[model samples]
Target: MAAGAPRIFVSHLSGIAVFDPAGDQVGRVRDLVVMLRVGQRPPRLLGLVVELATRRRIFLPMTRVTAIQSGQVITTGVLNVRRFEQRPTERLVFGELLDRRVTLTETGEEVSVLDLSVHQLPARREWEIDRVFVRKGRKGSAFRRAKGEALTVEWTAVTGFSLEEQGQGAESLLATFEQLRPADLANVLHHLSPKRRAEVAAALDDDRLADVLEELPEDDQIEILGKLKEERAADVLEAMDPDDAADLLGELPTDDQERLLRLMQPGDAADMRRLMSYEDRTAGGLMTTEPIVLRPDATVADALARVRNADLSPALAAQVYVCRPPDETPTGKYLGTVHFQRLLREPPPSLVSSILDRDLQPLDPEAELPAIAGFFATYDMVAAPVVDEAGSLLGAVTVDDVLDHMLPEDWRETEFHLDEEVATDGS
Candidate 1:
């Protein structure tokens, strides 16, 4: 084997063949076993399964294996036919060792792992297996128990072979946010190093980034934002709702906040500025620029087509508003709102006015937070349209925006916990 090449392990005595000095097949590889010490008992090589050309499986001693290579195994000597007749135990030790999860100690916490490490002792010319490293679970807590608390095992503590399954059909060493639930992603973020966090943020698409950001704590959001370049920070902010953008920007240094705002699109920047202009705890401050508006004369087909053309967020309101003109009043004078599902099910050629629900509930742009929350709760609304005093439609507020205000501190902490959990689980 070449020095420093990736190492591989095969089942000992797994019907491998070896060549002698004359370049002839000698015998099948029998056993490559290691001894474990559980408080000073004499170590044993442990029996291994070996097979011969006669189609017989046998128990082979550990000393038989001479060399191991990428594609084949070599044995020390040719075996007698009768020696291969003995049957070995059907169960393999390695499989049993890996079947259970391990917990390693780290910074006074236990970390769960799917595998352990194996090492060779040159001085004693023996192999040693000790210390298990965890790859999943809470950011700082492990699934397994140790002496008092899980002990942090050093990298050097791992000596030889890794117990993790190799080759195909193994769990991936690297985990992506897609593989994790939003809650899990939040937990993992807390444990990630600054650079790793940046890498993960950079890897997430705009929509996913927005979702993950909404779940993160304010302090974490500010920390992550500080680490990102202006353009990337702007991209993440652009993906966030106006209220979220305002809150995160409020947490950042004034200069950084201004620089990021400058990098955002003019319209997005304007909306964020307007939202921030209001007191942080008001309805206008939390509304989104995602109201569904349709011209009164527009047919159900036209409205559906417009919906198709627009890049609407998933959290958008189900109700589509009907307006006489873009700048006209949105009160009783105009055709009201219709559920999107109703529009889709109705005949395409039907006029929006024929199905518009006139029993519309509108929100004042300057309404207080509690009143808006009550409106959302009472009506069971995902979004409520906001209008000026003259009833000119301003924008809309979604449930998530309201949630930010209702439980600001708890929400931030939950997000922080989630980020930490994901990092530990990912490792």
Candidate 2:
């Protein structure tokens, strides 16, 4: 810790309420923002990412922070409600720094960073990292440190393995990304250099990479896909939602797409080929072929479990499809749909067929965008089934995919469009 300077560990700051001079709670600390610099100098603290009561994230500069105490942070009441955008030199302390690998200069042993402390310079507006909490043993739990036994060391005595120090290496990048949600990781990936982005993408597991790819803009998705080996790219495509995978494949040259598709599993390749046959704006093109399917004999409990799958998006999981024998697309037969709400209201052991919305018809595979939108509005459903001429369930269109088609082609690149809830306090 700096001489006579009050300090708080970064981990302890999570969820700490922020109060104005009058002790009126304004928001809570979400993450600490800092600038990454060259040399061994500690990264300069930039501001705090604060979440308002309304759940909007905003930036609160260090200049507005008057005091940092246990359980609460006192601020100058001058909060900037602008959405926090990390600049090229900046990083989030908790997001990219906490839980990272660092080497203790004195012991020459690698340890996991548990927390970091920053201190303001005497009579100055500057705040810089001065102390770090580290735990011995790379595989040990981060919370296993001895009680009241401070392992705080001078920041200069240890080395951070973040992107700035590690260059385009995947290990350090993986360390940071491992803690982030796929969408959050995607946001960070979008801001990195092309080479760095490729390195990070290569380091991610197929499923994790697929999740992150689904969140990236179409252009970014294509560029990163091009960097991967052909076989690995095929695997990632298979892991992605069939709709998203097909859309990306459509952007590639026909021969290139064919070669890559041939590398994928036979079943997956067939599905992608089928999806590619539909126009991009049609219901078939906007649907995922992997919607949870249940036999009529399946119970409500089974329906609930399927919708809770981590891989399925919330919109796609809003309902379950009731199909006849051979519960695969093109399914044996389309019976009806069962909304999750109905499952919750019904007895756990009740058959799914008993609660099926038989009157709810499926969309034709070639249904246009306007028709799909009308179906969602009229039925008040997040997803609707798509069927073929033989009445086989091909897939289900999700509201998110429909919205994507309705928006401009470059909507993902538009800052305001990316996050609908992002707004300012009129400051």
Candidate 3:
């Protein structure tokens, strides 16, 4: 909780009233609006948008916030309280200037504001805004004319408000990950700043963190890990699939990688290190150590019980591997896999072998990328088991790792991508 950061009780928000410095009751707070500022020590609070009488709304500068009490917001100055000038074109609070025309200093060309992003100065309380978007207007315009010139103001150009002037005590109404689906969380993460993202990640428990991390791209995983403390990072990594942990650790510098590994429990670190020893593109590199394995002679009821009781990873495939007795060498004898969906559709007393798919195609530890890809392409496999030459089940790889190799870089630009556009509106 750095100084000047809004102290609104985000979790306990409800029935919180907002008042101006003049002590006039404006309205109850509907939500606390926030803007993400990357690389900033403490992310900036752009302003607070309050819901007022008759569905009216007003944007109050963060500067006017005075105090954030349990049930009310206190402002340092009186707000106009009149209905805000409607700007439906600027529906999004972020990059509000997008689509508006502005003049570029060097090129002297009129460009449509496509996006606005925030960049924070490390170790400082300040933020710089960046704008990005496609250019509009004639090619040779000496002086570019700004569309809606009044709204093209840069972030720095506005300086009338003070830290305490923004209406204080309004709470954030955004849903937590537990409250949102994974796809929804993905969408929200795209909109948040790095610092804000860390806050959101910190809120998740190890289980949820594991689920979310698997869904994020490798680059995003690295970015998020870079922002977290070593302890928190270790917690997240340890909870993830072993192969994912190895991949993420491999992305960091030598010192950072070692430091994080040291922070992990010995068992967890050893497993990750073993996985890291394999080439990243190989089957050995992508396999997870925690595959669901059971004895080949086990009854379907027994196997089903284990599946129900086991704390399976979120990335678990629909099938459970069955091996012969002496579980350690089950992959050697190669019993087969029981498709969970199929088992549920059959009688409970059926033998495991009756439901097993014996024609499974296994991957050798030393298999090359092209061979691995072709195996998946030929069989339409969702996951494949990796085995040693002796047929010992070493681990298993899912389709996700292979897909990562095929995707292009920069497929999804982060919310921070628009930082330049927002910065252009400097004081």
The candidate scoring highest on lDDT is 2
> Tens digits of per-residue lDDT for model 3 on 1-427?
2344443323233336777655666676654345433232223444456776667776654445566665777775555454544321113233233345555644565555543444433454333343233345533221234443322334332221112212421123133244664544654555455556666676677767766776676667888888778898998899887887888899889999899999999978888887888898898887887777877667778767767755664345457777665564224466677877777887878888778886877898788778888998998777788877776777777776777655555433322111122111122
Candidates sorted by TM-score, best first: 2, 3, 1
Error of 2 at 414 (Å): 4.1
User: lDDT, candidate 1, residue 147?
Assistant: 38
- Per-residue lDDT of model 2, residues 63-94, tens digit only: 66778876888886666666776654478887
Residue 211 error, candidate 2, Å: 0.9
In candidate 2, which residue ranges exceed 4 Å CA deviation?
A: 1-57, 60-168, 414-427
How far residue 271's Cα lies from its native spot in candidate 3, in Å, is 2.1
For candidate 1, the TM-score is 0.55
Model 3 scores worst on lDDT over the 10 consecutive residues at 416-425
User: Distance (Å) between predicted and true CA of 62, model 2?
Assistant: 18
The prediction achieving the highest TM-score against the true structure is: 2
Instruction: Residues 1-427, candidate 1: write the lDDT tens digits.
Output: 2223332333322455654434555445554344333222212233345554565544443334444564465544433334432212122434444324433323333334433343333333233334454444444322333433333354333322232222412122124335675545654554454555566666677766676777787767777777777898898899886677877887777888789889999878887777777777777777776577877777998878766744565456377777667532233333577878888899999988899877767788789889999998898778888777665676778887787778747545431211111111122
Candidate with more favorable, higher lDDT: 1 or 3: 3
